[model samples]
Target: MATVTFIPAPAPDHTASLRAAVRYGVLGLIVLAVVGSIVATLLAGMPGLYGALLGAAVGGGFILCTALGVLFTAKLPATTAGAVLLGTWLLKMILAITVLAILKPLDFYDKTALVLVIVLSLVIVLGAETYGVLGVKAPYVEPRAAGDAEPGEKDAQ
Candidate 1:
């Protein structure tokens, strides 16, 4: 009978880690941009001049937060990362509703802002999840022939 051996999959490396980081960063930025634009439009009370600026700020801030969060918690699992995102979304929603309710009684709150907040919050959470999934790195492995040298090399007999 002939003997058989199986080779395991190769481990992840630094290049993979860097690539993940970049991918997550871009995802974060895109999410922020979309959410920001919507919020800015709502804030402008119209699709006029100032809306564009507000949208940019909102989107930029969201992206920045996501990047920082990923950088700080890169070791977290995809599920845990998702949970964190969901928690943030919940908090934002609660805050928006509470603030709107409080201000509505005084005629100082805009109903449209609530919608903007909800949309932005969802974008942020989804973006974070996307980044978390992309950034995951598996264990690394050493080459099988690390200790072996080719003919005429110093370690070769």
Candidate 2:
């Protein structure tokens, strides 16, 4: 008698759930950063240009942190992803504040124009991320058995 060892199949929707979570989490963070920048500017009573520059700096930093988070998550063990993201976010935040402070010495556009630029940059960054996520290819093809002919192809005798 021959013994057969059965292997368990992968969960039907595990990958789908993971992809959805990743896409939504990234999008949510992007939105939050933009909103935070807008609120901060409004509260500070800074001129539009200053607000715009500050917002742009913050948004750009968030995007960079996000990319690093994703990269680290992919390369490291699952247990470490959250910690990596936190560390990256903190570092980016510090750097962004520093840049904004240094740029204070330089004269840029007026307040309104600066605010518009910041808002536009945030929108553009979010749009890019959304499009990229939507473009991800889902693996749907199943492997064929040995000696089997593919669809529409004739088999050799």
Largest lDDT belongs to which candidate?
2
Candidate 1, 32-130: lDDT as tens digits: 556555565555554422333333344444444544554545567878877776676566557546754654555323334434544554565455555
TM-score of 1: 0.37
User: What is the alpha-carbon lDDT of model 1 when measured against the actual structure?
Assistant: 0.53
Question: What ranges in model 2 sit over 4 Å off?
Answer: 1-58, 108-111, 139-157
Regions of model 1 farther than 4 Å from truth: 1-3, 45-135, 138-157
Question: Model 1: which ten-residue window has the lowest total lDDT?
Answer: 48-57
Structural RMSD, model 2: 13.2
Q: Each prediction's Cα RMSD?
A: 11.3, 13.2
Clashes of 1: 0
- Reference-based lDDT, residue 64, model 2: 44
The alpha-carbon lDDT assigned to residue 122 of candidate 2 equals 61
For 6-55, candidate 2 gives per-residue lDDT tens digits of 87565443244345434654565456446655655575544543565555
Candidate 1, residue 2: the lDDT equals 90
Clashes in predicted model 2:
2
Q: Per-prediction TM-score, please?
A: 0.37, 0.48
Give model 2's TM-score versus the native structure: 0.48
